[model samples]
Target: MAAIDVVVPNYNYGKYLRTCVESVLNQADVAIRVLIIDNASTDDSRDIAHSLAQDERVELILRESNAGTHASFNEGIDWAQNDYFLLLFSDDFLVPGALKRATDIMEQNSAIAFCYGRDVAVHGDDPVPIMPGRTSPVAFRLHKSRAFIESFCRRAVFQIPGSSVVVRTEVQKRAGHYRTTLPHSDDYEIWLRLAMLGPVAELDAVQVGLRTHDSNRSREFAARQLEHILHTAAAAESFFNHEGGSLEDCGALRRLARQGVVGRAYWSGIAHLLRGDMEAMRLLGFAIRSSPVSAVVPPVSYLMSRPDLAGRISSFFANSARSRHIVF
Candidate 1:
């Protein structure tokens, strides 16, 4: 059996630590080691992690000061000794047979750098897989690097959630670790770089249970609409240059991607307005600053009252378009 190392980087997430560690241990058909790195959490994370470390398969690293999640990601990646590596957040867990499913495809295709699957959102005790009615149960696909890059640029595939992805250990080392500079979009940047080296495979089945709560770190940063917009723009610029795209192509794609950013910011501002938040104007400012043209493009008439409905309508149009990147 191939060996895999799963790294769980946590900060004040002690309450969900046990469930996260247990899920890694439960993965079958693979030799696995779980590394729990706690970043000086204030909660009972230390005691809980220590107890979980008592198991032979798990190792606990206690940090003296909070180094942040990306720092912990680099620490775990440097320490791993397995064939494959997965960085699962403390709040999420793997579904049954997830390791087997990803590993089987990776082993058979040596050129594949990484594999990812869909997620099942868990609100309470029950896990609800978000597979749509038309989704296939046993469908999977492999995309050559160039094709994947083009599709990714056009927003064909949905964002690959970091928790549900497993990358070849050596490929991670060669492609480099997550960027400490990009706090908001490091996962997206890394995925783009990895796709440049080899193919990326996708499993249609849900592999990770993504838990939603008020304390999520992502939510905290996502609310800062300007930061999100800037980071996304930076990632697109960096990826476009790295892929050796022509100047004309880069300009066109960058404009389209930034327009998407502005559309998101506009919708976010509307959401804030609906909730009676004071930051609505600030988000609107960000939208206009990012892309003045895209900011003024009125959304559908029905979207004026419900921002959620606007998102669904926008997504339908995005998926339907093939030749160009659709921004709102």
Candidate 2:
């Protein structure tokens, strides 16, 4: 059985703390230890941590002052002294037997750095849909380092759920601590770093449940789509500049990431346009200015395909070639 250390970082999440901690403790077949770090929460979180610490496997770190999320993340990295490590936020939890599933893949393939799977999310107080237990044979795929990076760099989404990712302790330390500067993209850069180190494993099942309440920071970030686009691009830049130097074709990968950013921004703007989000124009402008040559093509292609789209573009840009000629 692998020894796994789960660091549960809390901040006024007392209500969900017990369930989160319980989920970690109950992960089957692993010798589990929980480090509950209460970041000077005003709620009854400290008391809850103390009560949970009654179990020998649970430990508490109570701070009189509040350190930010990145600090807690780095602290967890420092506290990780087991074969496998996970940073499970107090509001999120591991799916039953998830750790075992991740560990099985990593243990079998020593070169695998981390394993990630899907996470089913629920809004405040809503029940998390239960994931049926898997009775079938699992076909875990081990993705090649460069190949996975190529595939990953083509999309701008946060492809993996944080709660569902389990990493190797030694590699996590080698990849280094989360950057305080890259606040929004800290996970983004780190995941890229981890993938660069070795093969990446992807589990087919939901490995964690992401619960969002009123105070959920992830939702706050998601609401600002423009910021999300900029921060994601920033993450790729930081990764290539700081750590991805040794890869054989680092330059090519970096270019792909840059193009991917514009692609994401363009699509995001169109999505907003379809929803009548007035902010769509702003995002489209950002994408166009970021790379005029590549960015203009997407909108241009859409205008050529549909007269309706041409009219829409003309409404936004009166100087469009199609609308000018159509009137003449």
Highest lDDT against the true fold, candidate? 2
In candidate 2, stretches whose alpha carbon ends up further than 4 angstroms from where it belongs are 128-132, 135-137, 299-328
Whole-model Cα lDDT of every candidate shown, in order: 0.75, 0.82
lDDT of 1 by residue, 1-328 (tens): 9889999999988988888898889777889999999999999999999898888999989999998888899988898879999999998988878888888888888899999988877764444453332222346789887666655454412367679899999988887778877777877778878877789998888888888778886767756655765677677667666642543466676565555555556766765665556577877787777657646574333234333455755664565444222222
Candidate 2 per-residue lDDT, tens place, 1-328, comes to 9999999999999999998999899877889999998899999999899999999999989999999988889999999999999999899987777888888888888999898988888789775567666532356878898877776566654567998889999999999999888988899889889888899998888889999878998789887788888998888888888888778889988887777777777766876776567768978888889889755468343233232455655554554433232110
Once fitted onto the true fold, the runs of candidate 1 whose alpha carbons sit more than 4 angstroms away are: 124-137, 156-158, 223-227, 240-256, 259-311, 314-328
Q: Each model's TM-score?
A: 0.77, 0.88
**Residue 134 displacement (Å), model 2:** 3.2
